[model samples]
Target: MSGPVRSATTPSNPTDASDPPTSLNPILRGFNPDPTICVVLASGGTPTIFFLSTSTFEYFPGCAIYTSTDLLNRELIGHALKRRSQIELRTVKPGADSWASTLRYRPDEGRWYLANCLFQRYRPASDQRIFPRGFYVFTDNIWDDNAWSDPVYFGDPGFDQDLFWDDDGKVYLSTTTRLSDRAPDSTQKDLAIHISQMNICTGRTLTPPVVIRRSPHGIAEGSHIIGRNRIYHLFTAGGGTEAGHQGPDAPAMLLRRQTSFFQSLEVTMEFSTQQRGA
Candidate 1:
């Protein structure tokens, strides 16, 4: 279960309170967590619309999707995983189902994509929770419940998986990898961000996965990449998403590529602390 949803917007004049920017704390009330949102501008006579999707751990219909026009009022259009053939949850741990999903619009493809990972079935001998491959589903009819296609699986065993389509028409996948996966001596809780070129249609990796950056503090996940002005930026959370560890290290980090691609990345800035289920 999750808490209420709220957003804050700042006005141009900080002193202006007469008709100040207003928002409703818990605008969306219920068990909606790790919400990923995108906006589709008006085109071809279609009106502009905002789309949103949230993680639904151990729950049927995996990711819940919604749509809005002004970002306030929302409507439950459908879900990304609505059919039984789309997912299997019998072995999923109680609270470890589908989480940290991203929903994005591929303008060139004229379709929407939802990338998610399912954590299910634990390995008692190794004491490691096995992730059943990262997968993504696509849909052209946003409002139709049965429009989403079956998942296209990729061999990335990580959480908070994200998909980015670069300007050159190349698709990139980003996700977390436990430090222990590389250095067996390191703590398993520590995670590093990784990126790879993948075929969005077939879920095939074109390039070997590259470790872009390591978590600055405790853990790093929820990575998103975007390109603009001939520059690619990578955003991730650090320190820890859990509570009680809120401090200087708990801020979200911003890193950008040194060149046109993911050859090199450098830390450029840092932002607010992240709290899990808070």
Candidate 2:
């Protein structure tokens, strides 16, 4: 279910070399953001793709799901959170309900898992305060509207949290953490990518957070882990998402680890622009 970082390049024109090419139209319109997709293989060897997009600060139904068999056409399936017990957002701000989310399927368990980060200022109906919290839900059947389980809150690993299930039945959660919080004046880096063993069933951390990679260009977020060719690939989007920003120089970076996932040795890949100062 893991793959390489998606390309942002627009295709070249098929008619003429001098003419500009068009990009694929948006499959899901509206305010959906931070989309995470997973491909599921059925018993008959058919591939079913599922997509989950962030519905930040939206109503009761937070994250939206879409299903596609051909990858080109997608159909609106259902929302993950339907009941108020799943997510209570009446007291939350307009744009602070939920953030980037990831959809993952566990073959052994025959279930689908959805992990998302919730941005809340304070605890509901209490003076106690809490930072951002990440939570996950699972469903035995993705096609059913009421199949998803209740939200299981986990620790705050910041935004764009991802779930990676290894071949050995170990589950890991990867996200961006602030290095400045530990060392404010440290010039080595400001943000770092951290990973920790997670008990997906109970939403608990099995080990302490381990710093796998530090951002060299800018703040790292939107992290995802994939294993291919016996190597674990950690892909992240760095810099900023704004236009004319540091992100242009290096919008994405990839790190590869062999033998062990705890090793800090990394190979950073910088994105290259096709043209400059045109």
Candidate 3:
């Protein structure tokens, strides 16, 4: 369930008792996690931000959306999927219906896109948990709940999938996967991040998935991609989510590709102490 809307801005002077309380904090509360935001500037140059968060086994009306004009105050716009055809949770276990998701606006297509991994319950008979499947849906109108298209399932790339639409009109999908068995790979054989060219209309990959980054600290997930000033940046979280147990490895890591959108990416920076959540 969602919480009351609150302001994100805070006052500069907290010591002054006479100063009015200007900060409300937390634009969203309650079980809301793994938020992805997309910003668009209107014709008048006013900034409009759209936010989507994981619902994770919650009942129908999954993945709520919030919008804000100034980034301080956010209003509950609506949900992207509202029908049983869009999302079915009858067979999913608690807290496994949906994982980390991303919201992206494609200017070329004039539509908004949302990509996420759907988790299924473990089968006791087979003693195995079903691999999470990644899917995406788009809507011409982001403000309407009924505008979202049916889920178009893609290959099970990994958890926390994200979509990156580059200026060259090519689309890419990034997700966590196991280290490739091919040559020139990481010593850590278990986990890595992968990216591939994706067809926005059919949710199909056109190229073989390439390993962009390998986890140095035993684990890595939660991939997000953005392009700015001819540079593409990828943000990911590793070393687990817990605080003290993470040891020396950072919670968040950054990788960059300046030459092209889908070329080799090198880790440029890392936040050792930052507590990044999926």
Candidate 4:
């Protein structure tokens, strides 16, 4: 989906987020791949929501910070940690490993870490087997100091890592474990969900591995625990990628309508999920 991406900061030669007119169906435009979102209850009954966008291709991480009195049409407060992330991007793509991502916050340790995945020949758009486990960079108070912490690589999980926060002040990792094409069915475990506890605050992994959800089509690559209307909703995205990645040009994209909105993954593997369990 292409949406209007308004930007005041462009790397060197700034390009317009939109061409001439706004797009009709702008879903995830702005060259934003991995989207991490957080809703913070600010003082005076206000809520601030943050969305971070990364262009792993360019080896840069960029994000937009939006605030709201209501959830729809979140007001932009400018790009979140733009200057810091830009500088970090200059050196963050260490070696030949391209990056991938997921987002979450750690309450027990009072810090936030942007969970990411990286590897050699990392741009799976051309090939998929070369991906490797990656790291997390602790998000500092960049709003004030305009500085950043160094990225800390946490070693391989024997799989990829996408950070998920639980309800009881705990954090964890989830991902598609073994990427395979062999299946009795059309999908197999091709797109699966694996779970493990994470000490993200201390840059540690605290649990063994387990596969939680799998489907012929796919399970959402990301998950979140949030409170709304006095209840918790599990938000996730399932089955969607640009056609270029699926067959013709890029090997990364899979063809499926992306499901959005919230669901309940509190205790069971049930969901009012937008488009899943296919």
Clashing pairs in 2: none
Per-residue alpha-carbon lDDT of candidate 3 for residues 1-278, written as tens digits (9 for 90 to 100):
33346565555686776775565535565556778888775756645565555554555677878776666666777777778787787787766777778888766667888887667763345433355668888898987788999998776467778888777778888887666563454344355678888887787888888877666675567788778666777787776545622554444456565756556777677665444331
Please say which candidate is ahead in lDDT: 1 or 2. 1
lDDT of predicted model 3 = 0.70
Ten contiguous residues minimizing lDDT sum, candidate 3: 122-131
Count steric clashes of candidate 1.
0
Q: How many residue pairs clash in each candidate?
A: 0, 0, 0, 6
lDDT of 1 by residue, 1-278 (tens): 22223455455466876655655556565778888999999988988998999999899977988777777667776678888788889877686778789899977768999999888753445655465688999999887769999989986678889998877778889988766555666554566788889988799888878887676564777888877655777777666565624645444556564554566677776654443333
lDDT top scorer: 1
Please, what's the RMSD in Å of model 1? Answer: 4.1
Q: Rank the candidates by TM-score, best first.
A: 1, 3, 2, 4
Poorest 10 consecutive residues by lDDT, candidate 4: 247-256
Badly placed stretches (over 4 Å) of model 3 are 1-4, 15-27, 44-47, 122-129, 180-189, 242-250, 258-263, 274-278
Q: List model 4 lDDT by residue over 168-216, tens digit each.
A: 5455566555534345454333555555676765656676655544443
lDDT of each: 0.76, 0.69, 0.70, 0.44
